[model samples]
Target chain A: MSRVSSKMALAVKCSDTFNADACMHCGVCTAVCPMGIEMLPRKLFRYVQIGLEDKVKENISTIYSCLLCGMCAENCPAEVNIADNVRFLRKYINENEFNLS
Target chain B: MPLPTKDILGILADNLNQRKSVLPISSAAATRWAKGLDLPKGGKTVLYTGHLYQLIPIIDAMSGQMAKFEDSALTKYFGLGRNVNKFINMTFFMGMMASKDEQKDYDRMLRNIALLLKKADVDFGYLYGEELYSGALVYDEGVDGSFAKHAQRVADMFKKNGVEKIITVDPHTTHTLRTVFPEFVKGFDIEVKSYLEVLAESGIEPTNQITDDLSLHDSCVYARHENVVEQPRALLAKTGAKVNEPRLCGKNTHCCGGPLESLFPSESHRIAGNRVEQLKEAGGSIATMCPICLVSLRKAAKGSVKVNDLSDTLAKAYGV
Candidate 1:
């Protein structure tokens, strides 16, 4: 059984004001990433927006891997601030998971 | 080396904050800054180190802590065991590693900037033991709470000290103070200027001359984020060397890869290499505006190109 959390989605959304709902899933952010690391911004948003906590958890590497360089946001046709979203996810993951001394 | 994890980075931030800095790095740089100084004369201009230059000794030490992350427990758990070089990012453990490396060059660059500003009579001063890290690394690493607290403490210290204005040395500090602080702290008001902005405003003509072709590698923060692109070129124009432009220059500049260098070393190296290739194509000794850019780009260029901070370049121009 997989658990879903509206709280996580709400928190992530609040952390980054850019409405992921307006995302056309156009794959432009992935194309624009300098690292050429696809499967992020759009993919991560899709999982989070749907409240799939497990799926979001699974993509932790992809979420934190973003440099938050704003390159994708700069190039986004929809004007989505994907970099801030990545930063939010990173903050969410660090607080929700992981043990740090 | 094993990849740096949140646990490690968090712990390191906690530790560094406990002491207010990587003490060795700060203390060593302080020793250098104090050299050849007379009795204290108070100045209204607070020369904020932003803990970047002071942390150089620690950064050099930490950047050297590479291990076999390909087989580490974290890598195996994350399924990041393959593609060793390209996949790993540094944790704060790497950043906290203890070493005895000489911070002379780092210290020298900082001193030169201070001396140049003093020569230009900006009435600059440092906070000595009171200065704190701008929590930039923690903020960038997504450790928001730690950074917020640090920012508050730094802001409070500034208020207590009656710091009228600040001249920041690096872009990370400059950007954090100018942009990030306001968001985290209410009424986080203080006049902040990067040293380049200070120099440009001073309009001092350099007495020393450079015969070499001088090219500029703009730090992404200094160039794109802060719009401090033309000021350094203007200074170089007045000083001596004719400025050369890389393919990725000005607002469209490429990053030096330092931010990701911690999070993605191999990829950072690859980007930096590409940037260096672009810079070398423009063909000249590289002059940089940020300390991190000087380190990252120099790591890529590997001494084939002479790289220096704009502070050092101007210091030479003033025959310091």
Candidate 2:
């Protein structure tokens, strides 16, 4: 629940190369989540594209809870690697914390 | 390709000497390894499939659980500790190793355990089979066989026993029971939860101080499939110990290289070493939830860092 620092902001912005745009806003990822927690991956994708760091971190647990099963990639029309994006989000969060300190 | 049995034993020997604890090798395999060793009359022996036999003792020893079972195979070999009725064995191991004809032999061993427990007026049940719905989604296609077969068996057993809920130690089993089994075994009304989740729910507090820094090695079974990332962390946090985060942890977490260890030692070692380095950089003792991860990571460690199972860590902290 901590604030996202500038470093994390940079990472989130830089992760555009991983094709955050490919997400179709469907909720298959959330439906398959065994924890039954809502990740809103599509929303996170939109926020990241627009440099909305606070929105991303506010839903950080959703990102962290992802199983990284590559199921989303398999299902995606663009074949986007959504799991890797989630990992980058986590890395961004951690790197931001380190930088803030 | 066969496993490097001598090399594995040599490592085990070094660890036992360093920890100053007797390492119990499983009787069945050990006898095969030590072909000429004379069996002592009335000595108790434990039989495990090759994989589980190698894994369980090492992790248990590293976590200090092996010491509690003093009369175990390890103690018999080292000539230490009094024998107790309690023994640890895995059903998965038996299932993997037992030849079609030898399955009866395996069942007999399990039946013996049940008899021992019954004589003591203690009910015993082996927690084997699926727990979650998503587990069936993945496992139904794997080599393990159709989920329907195990689902029906579990349902019938639960109903016959008049059991309302089941707590599983392994997250994989917990998930399968909770989610997937409901798909095949309709009206299979039984609650499924992980042992750690249950303990956390009980509001148990750590009785002893754990001042050492700790890093969590999320089990692939738990983290990847079940999303049980925070429960263990919360438990560690309750102990007031500093929790370190690894570079690639939680969902993106790498396997402790368990499946690959015996088949591909060098690759497994590289992966384990990579994880160990992450833990070391985070500056804390690594704690893992899965037995497989504990064993694989410990073997992979090469003495560079300390690895402890979460239960063992909690036990030490609580002075249990």
Best by TM-score: 1
Residues B1-320, model 1: lDDT tens digits: 33555544554455445654422233444545647754143357788887686566566565554323323555433323222212233323433463434356777787888887777777877777667777777776667777777789989988888887988989888988998899999999899998888888887778877765877888877775678988888878866687889887786677777776555567677877888888888888898878788888888888898887778778877766
lDDT of 2 at B297: 78
The two-chain DockQ for each candidate, comma-separated, is: 0.39, 0.02
- How much TM-score does chain B earn in each model? 0.86, 0.57
Any runs in candidate 2 off by more than 4 Å, and if so which? A1-101, B1-141, B144-147, B261-266
Q: Give the clashing residue pairs of candidate 1, or none.
A: B1-B67, B1-B68, B1-B69, B4-B91
lDDT of 2 by residue, B42-70 (tens): 11111111122223443333334322333
**lDDT (Cα, 0-100) at A42 in candidate 1:** 91
> Which CAPRI category fits model 1?
acceptable
| Best model per lDDT | 1
